[model samples]
Target: MTRPTHLRIHQFAGLQPGPRLLVTSAVHGNEVHGTKAMAEIARQLDAGQLTLRRGTLTFVPIVNPLAHQLDRREGDRNLNRNLRPPVIAQDFEDRIARVLCPLIAQHDGILDLHSFQSAGQAFAMIGPRNNTGELEPFAQEATESALAGRLGVSRIVEGWLSTYALGLQRRQQRQSDGSRRAQLISDPHYGVGTTEYMRSTGGWAITLECGQHLDPNGPEVARLAILRTLVFLGMLDDAAVEPHRPAQPPEVLQLYDVIDREDMGDSFEHAWASFDAIKRGQQIGTRASGEAVLAPSEGRIVFPNVKSQPGTEWFYLARPSDRVLG
Candidate 1:
């Protein structure tokens, strides 16, 4: 089936001659914070309170509008996964990415905003394990610090999706040298699955997980997250904004791999915290063996199975993303 070219709605005209900042929200649909924040910021700019200064500002305020309406994780269809130019470019995410990426690249960096499930805390995902060198130019320390200020949390996950995407670009540059037709992963996916795809093509992108989905203030917090990202990317100066800082640093963790179970699916006991420790081979939960089930492996039970949809991950295990950083 063919997809629509422009699901065009309200166009912001020329916010700039070229995009200086690209703030996208709800790429996952259910995550609503970024959209609200972007809209509010747009309103402020219209009100003459905030300034765009030099470069343009672009926003895909509701990237996956269909999925956002449904409050689902993926688009009712999978528009995000296939981001390459030729293959069904009209699909939702692909169309938006096509329009969004080049515009974002016109600027210094991008601030792709996001939020997480209700159980999770707010943190910024910064990555590419080895690409902090490149990120240094894009995301200066003051900017990162300013982002930490707005997020109200100091926990920054290194080697994030965009970081790794830049890492892949570095690899491609080394191989072909000055060839734009280099062989590169279209959507740079780290072991972290869906989110990192934009990093490779979208210059510097970060997935800012802003608290729980159901929280009344999640949207507002998510908006601040985008501002912080802008500050870090140098689009916004630190003195212009005030970011709330969490006492001490946020405990950062590496996202290992998502875990899944078949029969009776993965489960856990009530009230276990996200970073809680578990013993090797300890029986954390069970599956219906029609008998006695067993624990699979050992690490610490990560993202844990909660009472929700069937296939939406039971749990995940991780050590840390920084431990391996060079």
Candidate 2:
């Protein structure tokens, strides 16, 4: 199959109109599982095996064409970070965002498929239950949470962009230059990504981290998630797809903080994967300045990236969330 060279959406609408749902993958070029899964879905749709029953379903299998061409994480900059139309369309990602952001706004719900850098079980990232003065003020938390629960994932995480904003604030306080702080203050939507942007546009969205990048099973997860989302949104008949249930009750985690890599020599004490448990006051890594990086509280480590650039997020800390699943 030929690859896409620009932003394109494949849309299918049912005979009777209902809610519009947008499903996207490959927002990050390196994550190919979602792309493969979406391709499979497109093939089935074209073959008349899968049909939308109520509403519209749109697919954007590859969001970042330039990065996908190179098979890298990003081109010029990370497309999933700082997702807003640039005042001047300078880089390729900026121009893509101009087209992608509006397309997201048109949908009622979104299921953004993604894969992570580390080895871990698949999990869903949800927004906060309430708009707590975050950059994105959304009232669709209940709806979003419900959508997340039905995605066939056992673990759900909240507090992504808000916690990232908090980390930038902390960095600003400690550093003399305060570049991160300035960026946040200057851009109210500093940490906004696809889901956050969707929330800001008055739509509910959930990001499903299918599994580790390159995991063969990740595509299957993505495929199931797409079908599950369609069923949950009433776009497809439930009888058309098999019901999915996790082996155990789902666990919800609230990400509280993000640890930044300070220097080139910064490294984790071990090859700590995502969801690795850590105790309060335990040394997780060391800074290039020879300072020990300790956990401020007991929680599971999220996204432990050893290859992170200096001053970028090395890892995140999250604990059990008190909010009940919708």
Candidate 3:
């Protein structure tokens, strides 16, 4: 069957009225595992094998259909960035955002499924707490954090907005120092993705990174995550659907900084994989001037992009944090 040109939403309403939970996949077209998982969930729902006991479960399997059709990350722009409603739609993604932002406002919770460029264990990206700036209006800080803990992932990352802001600030500083001018700030709102946009509208959202984009296991991980989220929200009977649990305790990571590529001469010492441990003072890469870029502290690297464009984020550095949901 041929797919529609625009976004497609699949709604599974339950018998009881409760919170609305939204699940979005394929915001980045190349990350297709979530789309597969959503399709499977829809199949089970249609086949009567899966049931929603309370609340509504809505799925957007392909938010960026154009990108999916092209098998690229984006059509005209990255749909994940600057998710706020625009005064005027600028591109294909912006036009979709104009329609999507209002729909997201109606949800109480969201799970945006995605996969990263590197092969690694699944992780959940948790937005800032309720009292934190844009999230202040949403008084469900504790609830959101607790929901992330229930995701059954081995790692939970926090402080995405702050880290992103820091990266932008660093880029601006580099531009002032005679480095090649970086791309002008396109997302001044600093809203990173679907999760951030949902959170801004007083809904709790989490970005679940299933695994490497091309890995067959990615879809399975995404499927389990959706099931676990349903159980966490009490939409599915716990006895009927057992959530996936890790063999060990999950490690919490707090993002502190982002490393952006400053110049064309900047490059990595080796093909560094995501989650690779870096000891304090270890040389991670080289600058445009051939100066070794050393690790500021002991931490594991996340989202290391060896082929990242100049003046864009090459990787992120994160360390263990004591924050946990009670």
Q: Which candidate ranks first by TM-score, i.e. highest?
A: 2
**Clashing residue pairs, backbone N/CA/C < 3 A, model 2:** none
- Output the worst ten-in-a-row residue range by lDDT, candidate 3: 177-186
Order of quality (TM-score): 2, 3, 1
- Give stretches of model 3 more than 4 Å off: 1-5, 132-138, 174-187
Q: Write the per-residue lDDT of candidate 2 for residues 1-326, one digit (tens) a residue.
A: 35445786798888898999998988888888888998898898889898888888889988898788888888767778779877887668888988998899899988999999999999999887776474657789888777788888889999998797887776666545555433533344556789888988888899999999989999999999999888888877897678877676689999999887778899899999999999999999998788899999899999999788776689999999987877
Please give the clash total of every predicted structure, in order.
15, 0, 0
Cα-based lDDT for every prediction: 0.53, 0.85, 0.80
TM-score of model 2 vs. true structure: 0.93
Per-residue C-alpha lDDT of model 3 across residues 1-326, encoded as one tens digit per residue? 35445778999999899879999988988888889999998999899898889999999998988888888787676778667677876667778888788889889988999998876888888876657454334566687677777777888888788888877766555534342122334235543678888877778888999888888888988888888888888898886456656686678888988887777789888878778899999999999898999999999888988766676678899999888664
Q: Which candidate gets the maximum lDDT versus the true structure? A: 2
For candidate 1, the per-residue lDDT at 158 reads: 52
2 against 3, candidate with superior TM-score: 2
Q: Candidate 2's C-alpha lDDT?
A: 0.85
lDDT of 1 by residue, 220-278 (tens): 77767666655554555675467556666565666554443434554554555454566
